[model samples]
Target chain A: MAEAFLRRHTPELFGLATLLVCVLGFEALIRGGVVNRYIIPPPSDILLAFERVIVEENILARCRDTAFEMLVAGGASVLVGVPIGVLLYRSALWRRAMEDWIGALAAAPIVLAFPLFLVLFGRSPKTIIVMGFVHGLAPIILKTVEGLASTRPVLINVGRSLKMTQSQMFWKILLPSAMPIIFTGIRLSWTFVLITIVGIEYLINLGGVGQLINELAERYDLPGTYAGICFVILVSVLFFLALERVESWLQPGR
Target chain B: MSISEKTSLAQEPALVVDDVVKRFGRGTEIVTAVDHVSFTVRQGEFVSVIGPSGCGKSTLFNIIGGLLSDYEGAVKIGEERISAPHPAVGMVFQEESTFPWRTVIDNVAFPLELQGVAKSERMDRAHHFIDMVGLASFEKAFPSQLSGGMKQRVSIARILVSQPKILLMDEPFAALDEQTRLLLGDKITQIQQELNQTTLLITHNLTEAVQLSDRIVVMTYRPGQVKRIVDINLPRPRTSDVVGSDAFGHYVAEIWNDLREEASRGMADSESAASRRATHG
Candidate 1:
């Protein structure tokens, strides 16, 4: 019967088995004192902390803070980045001047400039959101430029042949043509924003789930720290699910 | 504008390209594409521009279509000079130019949308043209969902919706198979006759030029210049069956004779260029 089940559900069975091995190994290492419990708490203790964080502690509030920061940063990135991308697409001089800079900025550690951001925006969620926005901006701008630039010249010629105005050509032909690529950029930017928001919260000791995790670690509450990290993971999963739903809702077909 | 307005505008040639010259690069490296090429299409005439490969037929077409304005001389639609794209001139490209994001009906309605035509009215007209193209069954299908020919049909419908007086087709069927090309040629003939659309088709296919054009303007190799203008004088309501006729064979033979020398010249030039690259590299 076990062999029959394994053949039918190999993928699921293998995945569960791998996870079980990990949990059991961790538990064994803890019981044998091969691993320090203070640094890496046992699976049972972490699971117990997860229950307490949900039922006893108000982890939802911190989750809400992180979610809100992500929204603000992601929204600002799109609003600012897309227009700048379009600007780069329109002007050859601007594109020549900024293209390399944009690429470099995207790969740079802009999240580390949180101290300057805090100095500018203060030690509030404002600084964290701003940092997130700045970190996310480059990918959105670069992608937008790429998407618009890569529109088939044949389509533009068709538009011109139809005597469409510049604005009309942009909205009707260019925008729709560039949409898939632009959305890819937006997704990338959303990821960057989420990372920046969480990282900033952890680094500067601001609000959000990141700060909670930081506090738990500082207090040497190993299980609580693990549970807080799990909360961050849950936030990320929910955020990604929501992003997928929104993307599908906006674009129906592949 | 209606047929009445078109008739009033018909006092002049539908389109004219006079002494148009286009060159690329700078100084000694400059290469002339279209060299003093001149042609005129009358009110409802179908003219095909035929040339050997590397001929500047496409450059000349672009000049007439106002896509390339940096040229000597003039291109006029009706009485007005075309320095930029005007509403009277519509171009059908050889490439897959349909918007893949839009459905057939929406693609057909695009020009009308640009003109801010009412949605219901534009859709009604789009549906009529879609049916004319025999793509009514797939009106809601996207370009990616359609065959190459169907997508071109959508492109044709889109251009027609804007009511351009002259249709400038740049080898529109060059990518399709021979069978599909001939079929589309027949459809285009029907559409041109029904709408009385003045068309200028650029093509490399002798059969296509002979089958569809009222007159075939044969062009010379590279720096393309008009060599001869052969009046088709074929009977109206031409179908693919017309190609089987004696006159069709005669026209095709004449065009082949006109093009044979130029085709050889073009081939020699390319072969020499390739050998030069082989040596230099």
Candidate 2:
């Protein structure tokens, strides 16, 4: 069975092998003392610290908080982004009016507005969430707009010939057709939202994965810092993998 | 025409076009894509529109299709003018209109679903047409899974389930290779003969026009107006072998001579615009 799976998925095996090599190489650099022990901890020490973090550090709660921010941000993006995309699809005039503005938003850095988010919301969960949402929303809106707008005129004509109501056309034709493109936005948003939440934690001194990593770093517990960093990487990869599975399941042809 | 004479064949039109004109752009530069062009597509007759590119043959089809409604003329089912699309006039675009999201069966079943037909009934209807298009086994296959010829077959199946009175095809075979185009053309002729379907096909392929059309309507380029309507005197039930005949060559030459200069100018304009775009970009 293992051999069969590998035979079917050769590229997957190669990618895993490469990732393992990088992890091993990073461990070797720390163990060999290529860098200061105070700065860079060995993987063995990191793993031991990781065991301790899992046992005592409320890993689930921090995860829940971060996940909460992501879910809210993702939901907000879908709600706002889909409608904006639909509106842009309604007319060439609307596309012309708002396309440049949307492009500008997609280009603008979220860090530039951190101070504003901080000032308005204060250093609370709301700040982190707002930050996550801010980072997350751009791609969703842009991709949704692109997806909905790019429907072939022929397909639309098919709908028209069917005597489909406007709402029916949107649900049955435009939305489904645009889904593959829209999923791209969601995928990018997930990563961006996670990064934004961590950034917010760092900037405002909130307690999450980002805050924990900062605290461990300040204490010079290189092993513990390594553990937190490793945890961050592990969680991020897991989140992305989960998102891919969901998107693939939802996309019929994929 | 009296109302009863017009309504002789139930709710469907015998050939309903009450002077339709489609315009593009605006102000002083407003280009009339389809000038007040009108023609009746008698039920069960194979009518073909031949012209150069951008001669608004496609634009005219779009208007009849109810895809473009901002036109100056009226299209009717019988006596009533149609301002929007209805399933009675199923269209197949020059490019494939098969839904990328759906399997062959589902794409074909789309019209039936819109009409609120039972799922089983629509599925049965879809399979019947799919079989007719020679894709019976690939009912569950997605549009992307099919080849160009197969994809167009699915597209044909999709329109067939609607049970449209008139089938409007806009260069459906233009994208295929010559071999596939000939094969599909034969297949189309056979299916239409079997179904007794009225079809209005638009194309630059004169051989196809001559082979399938009961009569061919040739039009002038830009501000597309009808140049002449020539009745195709060829025998019925045409096959690939029909193209090898003397009548076929004569028909092809006749159509080309009429359209040669226009076709050349259109090609030149296209090249220049493409070059300009490339340079500017």
Candidate 3:
């Protein structure tokens, strides 16, 4: 039993071990003057600076602001994107007309449009949120279309055989079947949203961990900058964990 | 006793597939899939449409089930002719149809839920069918946890719960191993006898047809037409045990004899098509 458990977790254990070795090796190299301390701080210094950055920079508030922006943007993207996707699925004309546009949107550097957003929404959290929303929307829409399209014809036939209404077919058959793929789109959207939000926060010198990283970097507080980046990582981890929970809740037994 | 009297032929016809002709493509590219096919499934009768691949059995099944509306045919369930999906006709697909997201009971109850049956009432009815399919203990189990055969049973129970007047099954056990297919065949026979379900099954499996059907409709190669209809003349409330009977052997051999030429023709057509593609490429 123990062996089986170990076998199951072998990759995770190995990953942790490799990470520990790299950290220790890097720490040793820096302390021994084999690497420059000014540019790249040792792992221990970065770890110790976490408390100082938290206390001095008010990192928690910045984390909260970033998280709030992310939540709004991510939520809005799903709310808007999913329906657009369903529309695309339901109407072939719309799909043909807009699918390539949506694909182009995904490929477009949406973060570069922050200036327009800033001008429209003002240089505030709204700009960051809007940028994140736009950045995230395309993937969710495309993935939703792809997911809905991938539903097995047999399943649709089953629904048709039952004489299910269009609404019933969408809710009971199509949505559930396409959910995993849609969740994948959500994950992709969240990643893009996080990246865009952080980039916008840093660019505009606004309120978020991104701004904290910027300030720490300007002060040449390398350890504190890394620590601030760690907090950003923390935000991402928390959101991903929450997303996983939601996905599992939505699709149990799968 | 005559075969008609024994097989309950006095009952009204539950389903009639009158001259179904389905074609694909258009103009120069047009290909006929099914042509001038007609059959009747009597109420409380289990009929199997046995045909080789490319013989358009699935096309016929789809037309009758209302999954394909563009076909040229009149598919009547009782008095009502249907060109689209009808509430009174339920179908079971050969592929895995159980929703992975739903529990066994929920999957079975889905049709009722669609019909706006109350939750408690649907759950009760779902449980009844779940028990009927012998998945009583696995009511809360998901489709992912069940074996292939078990999943098919769940799908069977699911379709049965809606209580459609006619059940159209498209090789519902074709994916299973030989043993599981026979076992499920017995289970389906039992279910049909219990519910007096008027069923029309589309399959290429001769043994499956002989085992589960009262009569078999054999179709010719593409532009598929009914070549022959063989009566089983076997007793009802039949089980897999009857598979060993001499009558069963005779029936299987007879169907195989009729099917051999059609099967070979289908194979030759496919091979020629493949070679044509090769040469064109």
Q: Against the true structure, whose TM-score is highest?
A: 3
Candidate 3 regions off by >4 Å?
A: A1-14, B1-9
Give the per-residue Cα lDDT of candidate 1 at B166. 90
**In model 1, which regions exceed 4 Å deviation?**
A1-49, A219-227, A245-252, B1-12
Clash-forming residue pairs, model 2 = none
lDDT of 1 by residue, A186-230 (tens): 888888888889889999987998888888888888898899888
In the range B1-281, model 3's lDDT, one tens digit per residue, is: 79888666546688888888899998899999999999888888899999899999888878888888997768887677788888788889989999999999999999898888999999999999999889999999999999999999999999999998888899988888999999999899999999988899999999999999989999998879999999999998799998999999999999999899999998998999999999999
Using lDDT as the measure, name the better of candidate 1 and candidate 3: 3
Q: Write the per-residue lDDT of candidate 2 for residues A1-254, one digit (tens) a residue.
A: 98999899999889999988977887888677786666666667877897777677765667667667767876787777778777776878988888888777766778568789878988788888877877777788788888887888778877877788988999889988889999898888777888888777766768577777777777777787778777777778877888789877776665
DockQ of each: 0.51, 0.56, 0.85
Better of 1 and 3 by TM-score: 3
lDDT tens per residue, model 3, A1-254: 99999999999999999999999999999999999999789999999999998898899999999999999999999999999999998899999999999889988888888788888999899999989999899999999999999999889888988888888889999999999999999999999999999999988889799888999888989999999999999999999999999999999999
Model 1, residue pairs in steric clash: none
Local distance difference test, per candidate?
A: 0.88, 0.81, 0.92
Kindly report which residue stretches of model 2 are placed more than 4 angstroms away from their true locations once superposed.
A1-3, A31-33, A87-124, A203-205, B1-13, B16-38, B70-76, B261-281
Residue A136 lDDT in candidate 2: 76
Cα deviation in Å at residue A237, candidate 2? Answer: 2.4
Predicted chain B of candidate 3, TM-score versus the true chain B: 0.95
Q: Judged by lDDT, which candidate is best?
A: 3
